[model samples]
Target: MNTVTRPRILVVGAGFAGVECVRRLERKLSPDEADVTLVTPFAYQLYLPLLPQVASGVLTPQSIAVSLRRSKKYRTRIIPGGAIGVDLKSKVCVIRTITDQIVNEPYDYIVLAPGSITRTFDIPGLTDHAFGMKTLAEAAYIRDHVISQLDLADASQDPVERASRLQFVVVGGGYAGTETAACLQRLTHAAVKRYPRLDPGLIKWHLIDIAPKLMPELGEKLGSSAQEILRRRGIEISLGVSIAKAGPEEVTFTDGRVIPTRTLIWTAGVVASPLIATLGAETVKGRLAVAPEMNLPGNDGVFALGDSAAVPDLAKGDGAMCPPTAQHALRQGRHVADNVIASLRGGPMRPYVHKDLGLVVDLGGTDAVSKPLGIELRGVPAQAVARGYHWSALRTNVAKTRVMTNWLLNAVAGDDFVRTGFQARKAARLKDFEYTDAYLTPEQVRAHVEGTARQE
Candidate 1:
């Protein structure tokens, strides 16, 4: 008797794009038709937009981490690892497991959605001194680090040291940077009341960005409104400026202004994951170039989307590419899945096109700015919209409930501002949070796979 084998579909990264793609594939295809597998370090889809709230103690990390195993409808086998390299010619992906073991995964169809890493420049001391806000660990570390700084400032007698410890600088005026500064500033404001010896005025937050305006996507009026809110909260907003040098004790801005600070949060931008380079394909601005249908050219059964793919923007036309946002990633993921199914079924593939639904910027507390569906909103109304959007986007009912419960608890009860002692054991540096050196070269990937084959 002859046996049949199902076509194996491998999707990398458990982010917004990868998760959506897998879910769509599970619904659209049968077990006999295809077998899906996802390669990710974690088993949850992190709701990244609300990471600021987690850092500020408004929400727990578990609330934002939507579990992949929670859904009974999901049938994809979850591989607990990060894909470090991919061989387009061999149809194999190289993954580094959480235990640091290297393994090779083969697939008939491949979807590359490994997302992105924090973008850093060669500024002196930047990697060693600055903190990042890209992952759950980083957010938790930042919270603990911020609280520890307050504790140290209260205990220190030296005015210089206390001042330096209390001053916090956050670079970039985009959504991540702006929300991080706002949420953390609120945490310090509420936490200082616990320390009677520390002066309340000593806690200074400086938000700087090279961009001329704050959240330019929010438009001029809304952007200015956000800037005013931050300023009203006593946050020093420095536009048209960026860090020239970073040190353990202080940071010097491009405007030649040196500010003493122990905490420096870098959220400027993100670049495509290093895994994209292993494919040896054409890229636009570090992102893998892909068709409107999100497939690699001349590479059958290979697709890329989300932050790692420069998918063309069909809505705008004129050769414009889609911006790296959650909205686009989610849509692209579904579209890619449909296209993959079409490839298998021998159906015509459709191009992806979706209009912008507008932007939302949550500035902590009751302050927010939003342009949902082309309608401008600000203050409490905008805050409601921002939170509403996040609440609805959460993948699971448990996530939504937990997030709602956290918001309620935070509203009535204040944050304890307790330090978890993570920073005391080791400083939270950029390199410490992001494993930038974990990727493998193409030669190494091929050699490892060949070696594994020989062993088997």
Candidate 2:
């Protein structure tokens, strides 16, 4: 009898990196050589850059998500699960299914692409009071929340309560934070036209951060320009400040300035998933440390990429790791696939090297700032380039068309800030979605195994 031999490649997470990695793997490996399986909680690749557009009602939720099952170029299995733990020694990954069932899958080669999660601060009431801008549900909820607040404010008899409802505070001034503020502010501006009684000035939008300027990574010139545009639009830019405390109807900032508001959108920052900590590997600054080839040191069959991995930057001098950005993640994923193929076929692996290709900040209302290849551009031209870059960066034509269509519609029909009121009362805070150590530790796993061993 002839023995059947094939390498099993298991890729965790369906984010930008994992999806692209799987795509390249399917292209490089023949069906007879390997069986590729992509494990993720969702079956869609989320276009995170356009998430603010979804929240602002400029685009539908489905517009920002590309279906994984629709890819016909590659023959790959999509396993729906969030990888919680991995035994590198045993080559077994423990994944938690959506139904809360645990399954152990053995693989010849493992790719760790489990993406990052929102980083929260120790500020009191931030966990309970603030809304996060990470996922589609959160973005959609924010849309409803913002519109509903305006609707309630317009109808309220109490002036203080109405004022509180009208004021919206956004924490953090990073790309996500800035975009969310700009998009949501434009949304509120258009939405208030429906309510004649409400004063446009009364509908306040505050963007606060501990940093000295907005979008500091965009550098001084572009960052200043973006901040100025936002300020001109009546969106208050509070630099070197943070929300000291948050209450149900009011927020106190570090500057001792108190603002009465019902909405607090948190886009502070993101840290590597707790899943990375479970890998039992050396990590640098919360990311799994990997060589320039995107392979785990001391492990031949393991690799990692994207926000979860701290890949060494060969382009930069000694001791520099690639930043957790989509540009690097996408490139890393493709390179990882190439290296993996090389490993399987007895070839050399190339190190990842790419120059920083500037940053772009879309400030809504035909205002944007971009520094592509060190050439800074601002205003409508910058907006054009920022959007064009995003459109070109998308993996598929369908996504590009959909995004362009949304943009065209926005330009023609303006924004529709209608509230769907989904997840109105449910707690959708960052802490609520956080995967705590209490449930992820070995003790919990042991208890779970002990209880479910017989059941299994």
- Residue 242 of model 2 has an lDDT of 93
Model 2, residue 295: C-alpha shift (Å): 0.9
Candidate 2: give the clashing pairs.
none
Give every collision pair in model 1. Answer: none
**Per-model TM values vs. the true structure:** 0.97, 0.95
TM-score, cand. 1 vs. native: 0.97
Model 1 stretches astray by more than 4 angstroms: 1-4, 450-456
**Global lDDT scores for all candidate models:** 0.92, 0.86
Lowest lDDT 10-mer window, candidate 1?
1-10
**Per-residue accuracy of model 2 over 250-281 as CA lDDT, tens digit each:** 99999999999999999998889888787667
Model 1, position 105, has a per-residue lDDT of 88
Per-residue CA lDDT of model 1 for 374-414, tens digit only, reads: 89999899999999998998887899999999998988897
Q: For residue 265, what is the lDDT in candidate 2?
A: 92
Quality of model 2 by C-alpha lDDT: 0.86
- The count of backbone overlaps in candidate 1 is 0
